[model samples]
Target: MKDLYYIFDPLCGWCYGAGPAVTALAEHAGVRLHLLPSGLFAGEGARPMNAEFAAYAWSNDQRIERLTGQPFSERYRSEVLTNHQQMFDSGPATFALTAVALTEPLREVEALKALQHARYVDAVDITDIDSLQAILGRLCLTGAAARLARPDAQLEEANIRRIGQARQLMQQLGARGVPSFVLQVNGQSRLLPSSAAFSDPHGFLEQVLAA
Candidate 1:
């Protein structure tokens, strides 16, 4: 058996671009996927959306779309990025994923995919708790939705711990960003090159299996 640690941030466009490869790896029988939310744009890291930031993010999003074939719709730009009322925060989404992780562990990636789609394609306000809960409900992840509706100390702690673990792993591996993949086999762990996830998803999986 192998353990694959996926370190990511829910709000990171690059991480969203890597979704297909990560989902494929999660489905593999021999791999145990542990999603660690890096809290990259959560809490104190959160920033209010401004014209300058919106332009920068849109530029980056376009590049990701071109490279990975992921859709960064105009709707997302107009609705999500241009809305200064909503802060650019991933805390709520990360917390919601934690709820899924605690309840329907196997469905956590599914939840992440759905949330990404909701924001980037469907133009939903994913930073909102109500929106997150609604998305979970649509996914038939009611248990997670319930946990999110009334967050407890356990959920909060677990979320923090997951982020802490992800950051620690990043520091240990000298990884500078999200979408970092670390493969563990035979009790040894090593960071996998993240480029293949966007450039050659099939090759990335083959490499993981071979390793």
Candidate 2:
């Protein structure tokens, strides 16, 4: 089986923009989809929401929408990006996904999609543990939700380890951003063309399978 590694940060607009293609890849039977949270907007990389950052994010979000046809709702713009009380952190969401990975591995990407939708479409504050837990529970992933609500040392270590491994892989590939695709076949790994993921998702999937 081929191993298709997807590197992404939950708070990244571009990663959210590439959601459809990644979701399709996860559903494909032949390839084993690995969801790696890069943690780019977590820990030390997290920042407080401010006017300048909000403006910059919205501008970039607009570009992503034009390129990928992913909607960035007005509510998200007002509630999430401009909400000064909330920090732009993916740590909690990453931890939630790690819980899902440890329990229902197949549903990791599903969790990610739901989280993205909650943030961008529904304007839910995914930076909060309560919201993330609610999301997992609503998805009927009770085990994962329970784990997230009361995290153990194993879950903490796993989340850190996953993020470390993802960062290491990014360094190895000289990749500097989220939504990166790495396809492994016969012990060989190659980076897929990033442009196709945004502009031509069908072609991107074809390229992955063909490779």
Candidate 3:
């Protein structure tokens, strides 16, 4: 089976922009997706955001919105972007995603969608365990909370290994940023376009399929 690895962080804005294209590619190709949770905003979780940083992120978000036509509502701005108290770390959400992957490989994409919806649409803080658990519950993933809390030794080891593998994949593909898509076939790898022309999702998927 062909493999398409999507290395991304749930909290990544560009990843959200590329969401439609990625979904189309996965569905059309019927390829197995390996969701590698890159710790883009990892570290000590939340941090105080100064005016300069806030301005930069908001401006970038505006550009993304204009480019992709993805909705970035005023509620999301007021609740998540403007609110400096909430942490922007992607670690907790990534780890929970890893846990979901360990339990059921097929559900990785679903878990990713749920996490993204929680963060972007619902304006929920995904860095918090409670918020993640609540979203998992809505998905009927009852064991997600326990798996995230006390990950089995083997699953923990696998998650760590996957993280390292994702870093190596990033290096191999020469990806410069999060939400990168790499197509590997017959032992050869190719880097798909970044967030250049996101409005044409089918065009992007064609490039991936060709790769």
Candidate 4:
């Protein structure tokens, strides 16, 4: 079987823009798709969502929307973006995704896509554990939800390990951003351009598969 690794941060607007293309890759025969959360907006990378950051994010989000035709709701702009109470951390989302992978390995990608949609199109705040729990329940992934709500040290360690590995991979490839793709064949890994994930996922897969 072929292996494809998608490195992304759940809070990234461009990662949401890459959604459709990732879905297409998931449907390919003889290919196993893996999601690696870069945790770009997690840990030290996280910050408070003040007006300054909100304005900057919305501007960048607009560019992604135009490029990918993905929806960025007004409610998200008003409620989620403008909220300054919480930090813009991808930690919760990334940890929740790790929880899903631990229990339901096959649905990891599905869980990622669901979380992305809940944030962008549905205008929900997925940066908090409670919101993430509700999303997991809605997606009928209660196992992951339970794990998310009461995260044990094992789960926490797993999340850290995964994110660390992803960071290491990024360093190896000299990748500077999220939504990057890597194809591994016979233990040789090749980094694919991140731009194709935003604009042409199908062609991106073709190029990866061809390589």
Best by lDDT: 1
Give all TM-scores, in the order shown: 0.98, 0.97, 0.89, 0.96
Residue ranges of candidate 4 with Cα displaced over 4 Å: none
Better TM-score candidate (2, 4): 2
Residue-by-residue lDDT tens digits, candidate 4, 1-211: 7798888999989889999888888888867888889989999999998999999999999999999988898888998899999789999999999999899978888888888888877878888899999988988899999999899998999998888888888899888888888788888887887677678878877776777
On residues 33-77, what C-alpha lDDT tens digit does candidate 1 reach at each position? 899999999989899999999999999999999999999999999
What does candidate 2 score on TM? 0.97
Task: Compose the digit string of candidate 2's lDDT tens values, residues 1-211.
Answer: 5699999999999998888889878888867889999999999999999999999999999999999999999999999888999999999999999999999999998899999999999999999999999999999999999999999999999999999978888888888788888887787777777888888877777778888
Better candidate by TM-score, 3 or 4: 4
Q: Considering only N, C-alpha and C atoms within 3 Å, which residue pairs clash in candidate 3?
A: none
The TM-score of predicted model 3 comes to 0.89
- Clashes in model 1: which pairs? none
Per-candidate total of colliding backbone pairs: 0, 0, 0, 0
